[model samples]
Target: MALVELPYNQLVQWVIARGKTPEDCNKRLIAVEELCKGFFEKHTSIPQDVKDMQRHVHCEYTEWYEILCDITERLKSTEDGKKVNFIGQYSYEPLYDADKILRAFRKNNLHIVSYSQVLQKQMTFNLPFIKKGIESNNKELSDYKARRAESLRKLNANINELQNRLKVYCMDIKDYPFNEDFEVCLKTRLTQEIAIKNANMTIHNYHRTLKLVEALDNEVVPVFKAFVKYQKMDKNYHPEETMKHIRQAVKHGLEYATNGNEDTEERPSDDANAEPEEEPLIQIVKDDNELLVAEDKRRIIFSTQLGQSSFRQLLLGELLELLSFVKVRIDELQNRSNAANYIFSQSGENVNELIMQPISKYEKYIEVINEVIEILSGTDSMKALSILKNRSDLEKSAQGEISIWKRCCKEVAEQSDLDKRIQVTTETLKRFTSDLESARKTIKDTKAKLEKATAEVMGSPVKIFGEIDNI
Candidate 1:
């Protein structure tokens, strides 16, 4: 009886209808293998005129049946990358015994038939769909890069303007009204620039991620599929050379995906647990004769000291936090001093109001700064250091401030600081955008090189499989 040729959709249904339990599939494979082996033996003793027909039947039974068995095994194994795919209401869990159908078609050596015709038909419909899916990802990657580039360009232009403004402020403000205020402005701008740079870096990372997606669609996934295809061509092909190429292609794909620069060298001893090369023991010259005979050993002295602190309840951790607070206060005082000096330098009517008035207002902050400096400068002992290191909230740690003065100084400093910070941030964003653009180009070039290398590796099958088939 002739089997009706099924379309891809109908073929999936036919296979689903024939699906069996994994245990049943395994039993069926064993029986089929035994029956094929028995039939091959019986046919070998036949006359030469009939042997050609027998040989063809033997190949079909072994080849298609063996491949079917392998597919069943894959369905059982969780690690298998490919398995019988089901559509709509069909389930793959019961495991389809497509091998049983092929074995039946072989008909115990009564006829020669190619069961692969069904498989070829299914693949013919599916391959173009797979290729189209991969192409869609590549198109998405191209669109993403274009949009990102435009955004980066606009950010760069804004930064350039800010950078120009900062330069003007620095060069022109040699003798300005409220010098401390002017200095505060400069510091604020510098901080803004740093923030913009960070934002640029984040965007660059996003761009790198997209590039990796593109590589997977264009290079890595296709190579992986090729490796699977080669294995399927002949189960016995076991091409070690092809596998090596596959591994290399996968590694290249991962590197691109992770935004890892290939120029970085690998170090085996990067982990702390890695053993160091054995070094010659240090030879102390107890005797002159022994010293002369022994190889010169390099002596490295590593020392650790432990001491009891005089402070009874002080933990080093708590003490460190207190020290941080003191340091922060000192920095604040120094910045105020600089802002005041900048204001004083200007020969203007408002110098007293801008610089001197604010200074008088923050007298308590100045006094705290003096006291902190005196205490830190005096302390050299563990006990003194421990006393200073105790943790407390910065606001409540040292309390002696008139609210009005604090507010007045804060307002003056912020007015100057904000002006500078805004310009600086713009420049910073621009600089980072430029750097991101350069990084993007480098990544693009790296991906291209990787693609070329991958293509060359995949193309080696022409040389590998060419002469071997004839031999």
Candidate 2:
């Protein structure tokens, strides 16, 4: 039998008349509307031009029409009472099978067949070989796992060494009387070493031998957990009781270190066989004084370190600001230079007049001096002082050469005996303007480049520290 094509509304009506439930018909209608709306959205803009003949529907429309047709034909052929079961049987069986296959593939096929066809092919021709391959793979995996376990053990050892070194360093620092300056120096050196060590780890990860170094850096938490577990196994203290003590110690240390106060009152101590009660650590008068002094020194050291860090940050910020200003000035100079160069290149009366010439030409020597001053001023005070001294020395040697050019231009103007002197003055002005413009551009571009390089250099440390904090 030939299937008759009907518009969507008629198809919906036919399905309803065939005795399917209103809910089923309504669902299909909603699907149709969504499909049509989505099709139009994908293929054509809203309020499309009537004159545009090439406008067409997208994939959703075709999909919806096919689905509706299939459903409608199924409804028409099935007995009225059995229509629902027929639809369910035909539509659901393949869908359920497909879903099962997908779930199975996701769970079991990590390294095996990646698709249905490949899975089928493997099962058909290579089932025995595949089983042997799995056994071989299992053996290799076991070997690799053993190697990884050994590597992890070595990594833990290295971390333990580093932790010991850190502990020793901290003890040494703690034993000494507090000096803010010395603390600052120690912190700076330690921080720099940390930075270099991190950089080396990143670069060294390229080699297989050094792969363990990267692993060592990453093994902190696992090793710490293992150490805690070992301590628990050794039963020096009950795991829960030991953890409580550690927590208490850390809390007391933070409080005493930050607030410079120690509770002198004593309470019950923990006994394995007896009931435990919370108590503060023992406090002595000398210990209180030492703790308070140490806390104060730490605060001072931190404040000084913070101040130095802030000062360096501010210096970089100022340098960046000066660089931005220099860039703007350079751009203005370049535009002026370009204009002057353009004027000189043109062939006309105005060209001879040298109109729009850079201001630098009339004051070439002065312009160069001003450029030197600007460049020097843009630097930090100490750097500026050095630059100024060097610039002064350079100016002395170049002054005579500059004067000769001035004399030559003046002599040419005098020989022309032109009444206006506008041409010569304008020409001279143009050259100076161009020089000023070029100098400005050079300074601006150089500053931007320097700022970019500095940002790139500092960015890595900031990012690394940020990641460590997050970790």
Best by lDDT: 1
Q: Report lDDT per candidate.
A: 0.33, 0.32
lDDT of 1 by residue, 1-471 (tens): 222333322322333254412223334445665554454354343333323333444442233444444444544553322444555321343233333444463343211112222233223433334444445544554554555455445535534444454453232222222234544443433323322222222223223323433433332323233433433743654433333322332233122111222322221122212222333223212242221111211100000000112111122222233334334434544687675345334434443333343433344433433432332233423222222222121112112111222333444455445445545544554555554454344334333332332233333211111111221
Listed in order, each prediction's TM-score against the native is 0.19, 0.15
lDDT, candidate 2, at 93: 31
What are the per-residue Cα lDDT tens digits for candidate 2 across 323-351?
34334334545666665345334344533
lDDT score for candidate 2 against the true structure: 0.32
Worst 10 residues of 2 by lDDT: 462-471
Q: For each candidate, how many residue pairs have backbone atoms clashing (under 3 Å)?
A: 10, 7
> How large is the C-alpha RMSD of every model relative to the true structure?
39.2, 44.0
